[model samples]
Target: MKTQIFYFSSTGNSLCVARDIGNAIGGEVELIAIPGALKAPRPVTASAIGIVFPVYMWGLPALVRRFVEQLQIPASTYVFAVATCGGNAAGTLAQLRTLLEKKGILLALGEVIRMPGNYTPMYGAESERSQKKRFAKEKIAIRRIAPLIADRKAGKVDCGTWLGRRLLSGFVYNGGMKQVPASDVKFRSTEPCNGCGLCVKVCPVGNIVLVEGHPRWQHHCEQCMACLQWCPQVAIEFGGRTQGRRRYHHPECSASDFVW
Candidate 1:
């Protein structure tokens, strides 16, 4: 059976899981990237269709949610999703399941894999030892999920807390979405910036543009923090908040992996 996995990853955690799952399924696996310019639902027909992405604000990222809303899939196609989060997936899987159901898509499987935390605005990157431990856990989770996906088994990952899922998560996620449009104004490059354009390229939303030598932020930011986290010279900062904090991307993920 043909399998295709669509993914959006700022760091590399989601991409890594998608690739691993694809390898294990052993068919023609197409790993497609969800870019920033997603404006329409596209048709997808395969024996199996999967989406792997991170959990943001206890729910789906706005772009990913938009992608799901517009996606067109065959009724019989086996559908699954995997959400990667640093902590509490909260309502992510539940939200996705509800959204897919609205489109008559039966999401057969929902899984969550915890990876090293990457939300630097809240905390610095985990220590190397801690990250190593989490990566090991991620590997085992992928192994367990692959066979189920290969078998087209049906199940879901449960989101916790009635209050969190029904009320709190929706509020926070919606507020985050509202803030997304103008969030780019908070990002600025430091004096260390050398016009390498790494930030411009790392941004999935194409929100960064190079003016003369340095990078400039456009108003439509996803706040994925890829550009800030992956800057080679540690030049990008979100206001004064991220100045001295550590940056993180999946250890196994490189800039090349993000190329289309």
Candidate 2:
């Protein structure tokens, strides 16, 4: 049975889980990039389909929400969704399940993998070390869940409560709907930016553009943090706020790790 994995990742955490599942099952993986970015074609025949992404504002990221609305999944394909979150999965899985059902697909499994939270706007650099420790712990836990995902097991995970959903949805839509405030979306340059333009090339939302050999965010960002997290020189910063912040990418994933 052919299985396909589709994912959306900003800091590469979701991509990490997707890659591990792909490796474990030895099935095809497709990345559902943010809108207006390159993407791969959906497979015509697959016994199982997987959707992986990080939770934003206790729900799906805006880019992933748009992608799910536009996605065309086959019927009765044994669909599954995996979410990576700093806390609980919240209502993200329920949201995906509803969206897929609207498209005539059944979500067979929904799993949330706890990972280090990277929302720099809400959480600052003070917790950087603790976040890394949580990430390490999550990685260890992922090993146990990987097998269940590979076997298409549908586990009864918590979906949070009505109030929790309302609160998260409100925060995400009102506070995180667009580019984070300038004070929040800070970036600075170190000595390592070689003007490679890789950051510009890999941005799914065209948030970063090169200016005089340095990359600058033109605002209108999705807060994916791909540039800062994926920069090779580690030169990018969000003002001085993110200085000394730990960059995170998927363990075995890179910019080219997922496409479309």
Candidate 3:
């Protein structure tokens, strides 16, 4: 199948998942960055289309929802989604299914893979040993999902029960999500920042720009934590809460991995 995987990532987990699946699916699988794809919007025509991204606030990131809304998929395409999260995927997969449904396209598959959590506002990074364990498990999970996608398998979307989904996602969906576009307001660079300009480079949305050698947010942030996690000096902080939090990104990925 001519598979095209459109993905969005902040700290690299979702991108790594997309890469593994694209490699395992055994075809011409093209990994496309969602931000870059949005730059030139067009009707997407492919035998298989995969939307891979990190789950935020128990649901899709606001930018991702917009991306899906703008997507134009052919009727016969096998559409799938893989949501990577540190916790339960909750209603994230179901949310994608609903969005696709609105477009008259049935989401053929939805899967969630748990990776190391990087939302420092809520917690610190896990132990290095624990993170390694997650990386191993992530590979195994992707291995299993690749074949199902290759076969165009469709069953129950993997979202949790309706009650759990509503209870978990609804709590913050209205309040927190509405603030996502402006959530960059919480980010600030500490004294350790040296104007390396790396944050500006890693931001997938081009939300960060150099301002007199300091990074400034444009309020269109996705909160992907790329700048926070990938900053070499441990400088970026989220609402002053992430000052001491350990930064993390997919071990297999680097600052230069955004080619797609």
Write model 1 residue lDDT over 1-260, tens digit each, in one string: 88889999999999999998999888788888877326334456578999999988888887788788777777788999999999888888889988988888888989989998787878889899999999899889888888899988987566667887877577777777788768788888889999998887877777888998899888988788898888889988887678789899887889877644
RMSD (Cα, Å) for all candidates, in order, is 1.7, 3.8, 1.6
**Model 2 spans with C-alpha error above 4 angstroms:** 26-40, 121-153, 179-192, 254-260
Candidate 3 vs. true structure, TM-score: 0.94
Among residues 3 or more apart in sequence or in different chains, the pairs in candidate 1 whose N, CA or C atoms overlap within 3 Å are 41-70
- The digit string of per-residue lDDT tens for model 3 on 139-221 reads 89878788899898874578877875787776767578888878888888888889999999888788888998999999988
lDDT agreement with native, every candidate: 0.84, 0.68, 0.85
What is the Cα-based lDDT of residue 9 in candidate 1?
A: 95
**Candidate 3, residue 118: how far the Cα is off, in Å:** 0.9
Ranking by lDDT: 3, 1, 2
| Total backbone collisions, model 1 | 1
TM-score of 1: 0.94
